[model samples]
Target: MNYTADSIDNLGISLRTFSKINLDTVFIYPTVANKPYQIALMHKAANNTYSVMDTYNGVTLNNHYIASVEKKDMNFFTATPDTNTNLGVTFRAFDSLVLNSVKIYPSQIGVPFQIDLKRNGTVVNSYTGLTDSTTQVVNLNFGVYPPDSNSIYNLVFASNPLINRDAYAANTSTIKYVPGVIRILNDTAQGKHNYFYDWKVAAYNYTEPVPVNFLIPRDTAADAYKIVFTDNPGAKRDLGTTTSLTVPDGLTINTSTDQGYYNYFYNWKVRTNYFKFYSPAEALTLFGDASKIYIDYPDTANSQNVMDYTYCSKMFTYLQTVRMRNTLKNNVAFRDNLVSTSNLAFTGALDAW
Candidate 1:
């Protein structure tokens, strides 16, 4: 519906004097004598801020247009403001949504002026420039982040043109990102076997294209591993005796949520080595008092069986496995005996037994 000064004046005609008047309807009303008419109250427009031009200040407003990320455009005509003799030129409008803030960039070279900011027809903030017609940017309004960050703020540039005759004003809208209300969980899960360690991770962010990294200890200090992922459940592998590893593909989340979150698995295999030697020649052979270097074990455990004899080159293989209990800590042989019978076996006997 269109509203204008002429339409408002005509709507104020007395129905008793005019037979053509639709006085029976609530939409028609007698005008208040000697009072200027105003536009009736109405709901705000969807997804847009209302703006108009003021010819008194040489202001020329163009139609507003909405643009999308896909380069689509939707345009709406600007609503001409109805002048108020009492308040001069005033605009009563609202923005489509909550906003982060507003800023004004003055393009005219004149006196400096203040701009008032509002939302839902309520004054929120105001900003004043330093000098007359300051050809720079100024903040008109500021709001809470993470909440109104994506909202569009309603703006009203109010100035005393009579006092600040040298100032001119122009402003722009700003939108920002505030973290969303999302929770994340990152944890490690133990597998059925003690040799393996599994992990699970999660997180949340406010935007897309998130970067992430995962850190895990190497088998040895000299090894290094770097993982570049683009999706969740990124990479999973068995950490063999090798000390080095590489990151697999498709582990990045790319979203603000779970930006740099990660989880992992590490399966460690305990290692132990054993070796023993002896001779089955004559008792106390020529080379009497035989001696051998005994390499110590990092941890201790009981051996099932071992050999006490050796002839030529005896073969001694090491046995490694997982323990159900703390045998290395409580076993007597693990503490006192350097080598157990099951730990190693010899093919030959000692020259003297």
Candidate 2:
């Protein structure tokens, strides 16, 4: 790209002059393939003042000087540490380092702590119910899984996408954290490859089905008033409005007044569009039938049903046909795509990004 001068002369001449010999500077962006490189550009202005600016990765600056012109661009690269190597530790690999928050009466004195682990932005393991009451903190560790074979793990947080509040330091009021290293060794360990790379941390909560309960008030007009449920999460029909409301699969409602009071549980149910698969057994029970079963696909922003995939269809068809053939049904041969195998029974959490 060519640049123009600031002003034009009276005779339509340009204020700036161009040199016949062009000057150019080439900067190679340091990458995980090589190492992280922080580049800085330094230049001296016509007035002899010097300045420097960071040209992180993709940015590049070029300067040209012919006469006594002082301005010239200087570039240098600083290697960024490789952070996501799986340095042989398991439980600490994929955990969201949570800070403990505990205090005594009147004065809430507490200490903050943070753990850093590297991750490839795409694949992250999940751990639920990681907590330490005394520290008021927890981390989600992947446990023994090797870091991605790709070797280059991008900087990503395990929690909220908008804000990462994971890394922290001990303090009374506020705690702060920042990425420290790119290796996977333990800070205090004397063993080799016992290091760890720290990146920004984010707090994350997985999507879960809202629980609800229903209760029918002791209305004097004891008409046969049963809750006609349309579609409340997984409970297809209404749990009969009786004296004591018992929800088999847990409920969030407390009352059963339609006209006078609004049912908050029912309202919440209507708003919750997705439900969690409690266990692998639950998933098999719900989707074991030959017919296609619809499951919430959180990875695709919960848009596409996993059952709709061609691979899923083939697997189901194959399984069903095997049973059918054994039961004296028509024996027809077919092919199945090897790509559609599923080891995950429960759906993963929605993409935090």
Candidate 3:
């Protein structure tokens, strides 16, 4: 692109391309000193209308070539102390940015001073400390400040003792700063025609979303379960189970081989083990049925004599007594043996009587 020095001094040149091209950086050389400039990308539609794609602001020419950059800007010049004791400036931002820190030239080194950043006359942040001769960057600590084209922001600088300071002002008796992403309007306390404190501001443009990579451990089990991500549609991945070893089948009790002993044992061990005690009513509900019993005794005429005994009535009477019932319930081994013997005898399978 070819442009004249007059155009570079007064108006910035714009070069249009026949085809679309991606731009990463832009370089500009200004003919004048201390002139503010901006770099922007514009898109032209079919209707010959232009829309801004991106913009970088608060840039100035200082007799050297500079590229369009973001995040930080510093403006400093040779200055002498003036009569002003307290200095402040008001500005507006056209885009979202974070105010990280501000650099100020202290009139009196090692003197206690205060800096206040206010929005709409309300102080949002404040910093008070002794001025340093080497560094004057006052950290704001406020993470991000939204863009407000209408609201005015005031940055105030004050000291305990009266001290003279030099500030930036126009020769035409006006605020002398260019309008860009961040625009300095005028002095807050003194107004538009007064001296405003020169400041170097550090800021950040809102960043774009970054792609993140997640490292997940592989599943090693043969029967590993998979988790499905429903939120990330179209980005689903079939990460197979990591393990190759098959899980052994759960151990099962063989009740038939154990003469059905395991059938009741399994029930008692797995189901009834959770209960600490069974109520008397519950025990009666479980084993309250009565069965016929034949009692055998020695008779005078015969070797064995069989007599029908009312065992149910006697058993009910014994169970009705709380002491007897508790004794049977507490002695689990005795109760199991008595139940086994009674079952064998009732079925005529008792071998040893």
What TM-score should be assigned to candidate 2?
Answer: 0.16
**Residue 314 of model 2, lDDT score:** 30
Give the better candidate number (1 or 2) by lDDT: 2
In model 1, the worst 10-residue window by lDDT is 13-22
- Ranking of candidates on TM-score, top first: 3, 1, 2
TM-score for all models, in order of appearance: 0.20, 0.16, 0.31
Q: State each model's CA lDDT, in order.
A: 0.23, 0.25, 0.37
Candidate number of the best TM-score? 3
Candidates arranged by lDDT, highest first: 3, 2, 1
lDDT of 3 by residue, 175-284 (tens): 33433346766653432222223333434221111111111122222211111111111110111222222111211112221111110101111111111122345545
Q: What is the Å distance of residue 224 in model 3 from its true position?
A: 37
Among all windows of 10 consecutive residues in model 2, the one with the lowest summed lDDT is 8-17
lDDT of 1 by residue, 231-291 (tens): 1121212112222221121011111112122112212111122211222232123123334
